[model samples]
Structures are given as C-alpha cells and as structure tokens.
Target: MAGLRARLKKTIVLVGMMGAGKTAVGKALAARLAVPFLDSDREIVKAASATIAEIFVRDGEAFFRDRETEVITRLLNAQASVLSTGGGAFLAAHNRQVISDAGVAVWLQADLDLLWSRVRHKNTRPLLRTANPRETLAELYKTRDPLYALADLRVSCGADYSIDDMATAVLEVLKSRPDVLEISRDG
Candidate 1:
C-alpha cells in the first residue's frame, strides 16, 4: 500500500508452530509488499515489559493468551499489514474468528522434525519447557495441526526453504486473491 509496491486490501496474518518462521517470513513478506510488519508476541512483550516465558511463569498461559487475543484483534483491525501471531494464537476460536473477519490467515506448514530443529535450542517458548521438550513439541504439533489447517491458506515449508523462499511462495499464493492482495506497477 506504499509507493509502487503491492497493495494489500486486508491484513495478512502468519500463523503456525513456534519455529514455523512466522515472524521472519512475515517481515520479509511485508518488506517485499512494502507494508508494515507487526508481531503480536513482540507487541505483547513490549506492553508487558516481560518476555512471553516470563509472562507465562508469572500470570500463566491463560493470561498471556488473553493479552494475545487482545493484541491480535487490535492489530488486525488496524491498517493493512503483515501480522505474525504466536503459535497458539489460532488455536483459540475467538482469535480465529477475529483473524477471519479482518485478515487472511496463512499457516506456514512444516514437518515436526523441521520445527524441532528450528526451535530445539530456543528457551523463549514456555510450552516446550518440559523434561522432554521434543516430545512436548511433537504433542503440540499434533494437537495444533488440525487447528492450523482451518486457516484461509497454507504455505508449506521445509528444511531447505529460506525466509525469502517462503515469502515468495506466500506471494505466489496471494496473487490469486486479488481482492485481498494485488501486485501493482507504476507507469
């Protein structure tokens, strides 16, 4: 929606597992389309002055999730932009409804092994803080797969795909939905 860049008629929300590259790919996609890139998790941390893990440890996941829903609903209703949501953001029916109403949700589908490899070393994910984090991640993956599939669109990723590659793939998929997104050229 800026300059000669692509025009986004609605918000584009990236939703998936922790290591699904939502924030990384969302930033690239927003830059490619010349739109704002906003991460709900980052916004939450900024507002609460604490990390997600800290929030979960203090106020609990339920509180963090409540804040997540509020931030997501507010961002989705803002100007057209790229919104990268938390992994569990779409698992909630209320958040899903809000996203569906004001934006297009894109699930960055990736296999569990790839997701594990990407997130195994991250201490920021409170959900994976278990005796067997890998097993926990697998459980989360299995439980959330069906929910993530309910997204408006899906963009598959692999160990070989880079952030730019995923962004390009998402753009290719978005090209078909001219009502939501459109490529523009200036004379």
Candidate 2:
C-alpha cells in the first residue's frame, strides 16, 4: 500500500467560494512549495475564448460547468501543481470526486462580511450579476460552505490575512496531516 505522504503529494487544489482568495492563495502556495499553479477558471476562459460572463450570457451555466469539468480533469492529470478552482467547481459531485481522487483539496473559508468586502466590486462573477449582490453572495456562501467543508483541509481566510500568510498556514496544516499528504503524493 502507498504511504499517506506519497498519496498526498500529487497536487494541492484550492476550493472555495469566490472572494475566498483561492487564486491568490494558490499562487502563493505554489511559489512557497516550488510548484506550478493553475487556475481552472482561467483555463476555461482561455479554452472558450470568452470570459465567464460571456459564457453565462451565451452558453449558460450548465454548458460552462461542463467545460469547467473538462478543464479540471486535464489539470488534475498534469504534473505537480497548485490548482485554484471557481467558486462553484466543487459543488458538482463529479468535480468534487475528481478533486478528492486526484489531489489534496483545501477549503479557504471566509464569512459573508469578508466575502462581501472582497467581491462587492468584482463585476466578473457571473453569479453576482444580480440586483442585490450582497444577498446573492450570502446565498452562495451558505450553499457552498458545506461543500467546501468536504475538502481535505480547511483554513480560515479572514479579511485581515494576506495571501502569503494564508498559504503558509495551509502548508503548516498540510504538513501536520501526514495521511492526507501521503494520499496526494501517491494518488
């Protein structure tokens, strides 16, 4: 049987709601760990040759989600890397299963206040294209938090924290969890 440390060394995947700082933390974490970083949403945008808003306006959410799954699958099959997924990436059971099987998933958590502070100005989030952005964010957070908890690790990503600080904290947590690290390495 593969050791825990080996199974968990494959990749570090950051999963959380938007404004939880997945991209920022994933980049910092990858740099700290000396690995490449990939944002699944960015990959999807590049592949579709369209922004997320455009995708939602044209192809709709289901189409965009299918594309997202494809991008995530490819990323998981790649070499060692840090992957940051969209807010909704882990909501799908298939996507979550892929993440669980292919990498160590970390959930960067923040309360509604922190999330509103970070994303209130971000016009790019398709889900936030609403009359009441804060309410939408709160609703999304309520739905996503439970799914995020399904990840292998969870870290509080408060507004007071820096990406580097969060990255270090995640590393510390991963280091202490030899069983998870082993799963990622050997997966």
Candidate 3:
C-alpha cells in the first residue's frame, strides 16, 4: 500500500517558455490522467490577489520571479497534480531542482517566431516590454532554451498545435516510459 501510494504521488510538471501552451496542455493532461491541474502562475496570482502584470509593474521582474519561485516550491511539494510553470521558472537553479526532485518534467518546445507571434500583442507579459518584441523573445529563448532542455521529456509543440494533440503526445511519452512513471499503458 505504501508503494502504491508513493507511485500515485508522482507529479508531471510542464516547463517551457511563454506562449508554449503549458497551461492549456497541462489542463488536458491532468484531465486525461484523472488528476488536478495547477498552474503556478495562476496560483501566484491568487495568492497575491494581483495579476502577473501587476506584480511585474509594481514589484519588478526579479521580485515577480521570486514570487514565482515561492509558488512553484509550494506546488512541487503537493500531491499528485499537473503543474504548469511560467516561461522563466525553470531558469532558476533552485526551481529546476524542485522540479527535478519532485517528478517528471516535460518541456514544450516552440520556436522564437512562433512565440513572438503568440505573445506580441500581450501587454501582460513584463518580459515583452521592449523596443522590439521579437528581439526580446529571441534573447529570452537563447538564454532559457538550455534550461528548458534539462527536462525529462521534450515535446515539439508547433505554432498551431491543439491542446488535445499536445496532451495526447504527452500521454504517449509517458506510455513509452512506463517503468519510470509506474503507469501502465493499459491503465
């Protein structure tokens, strides 16, 4: 019973850049797996009673990142659930460690052009407050790409991919690695 419970506590954390559909895919994956979905960004917003944009505008990027790290820490220690993190969440060493120690981490990879197209008009993204949104995204990708690559699995999520398709792909990945996940494909 202890072994069964331990296996059941394993979580799947989605790590990727902004506009990579982490939240969308996380929700679908959670539903497919019959687990709850928790977005760290959403959790932070709720905890602070403020939007992410407000946190960034008033507290600055570093401050917002600190809040994100705190939120991720709490969620990582929680029981079975799908966690969707912010774009820069994995960039922090401690944040990456928490994900690594907790459960399987999946990186949803998207190209810079696709990311810019998706986030260009979004005023809520503090990172995109730049003279050239494309350049800012490119720079962010360049720096964070390697960090995201540290995930246990990397899924190619193109610009127009559906949430269902992404969830299916993640399920397939888990199915292929049943030994690590302790989830039988038949189950």
Top-scoring candidate (lDDT): 1
Query: Candidate 3 on 1-187: residue-level lDDT in tens?
Result: 1123113356888989999989989998887766889999898899889998888888888988998988888887887789899898889988888888877788999888888788888888877888887888899899999989999889998766789989888876765555435552332
Cα lDDT tens digits for candidate 1, 90-119: 999999999998999999999999999999
lDDT of 2 by residue, 40-96 (tens): 999998988999999999999999999999999999998868999999989999998
- Scanning candidate 3 in windows of ten residues, the lowest lDDT window is 1-10
- Whole-model lDDT per candidate: 0.93, 0.85, 0.82
Ranking by lDDT: 1, 2, 3
Candidate 3 lDDT (Cα, 0 to 1): 0.82
Question: By TM-score, is 1 or 3 better?
Answer: 1
Instruction: Indicate the residue-level lDDT of 82 in model 3.
Output: 90
Candidate 2 local lDDT, residue 184: 46
Q: What is the TM-score of each candidate against the true structure?
A: 0.96, 0.90, 0.89
Q: Count the backbone clashes (under 3 Å) in each candidate.
A: 0, 18, 0
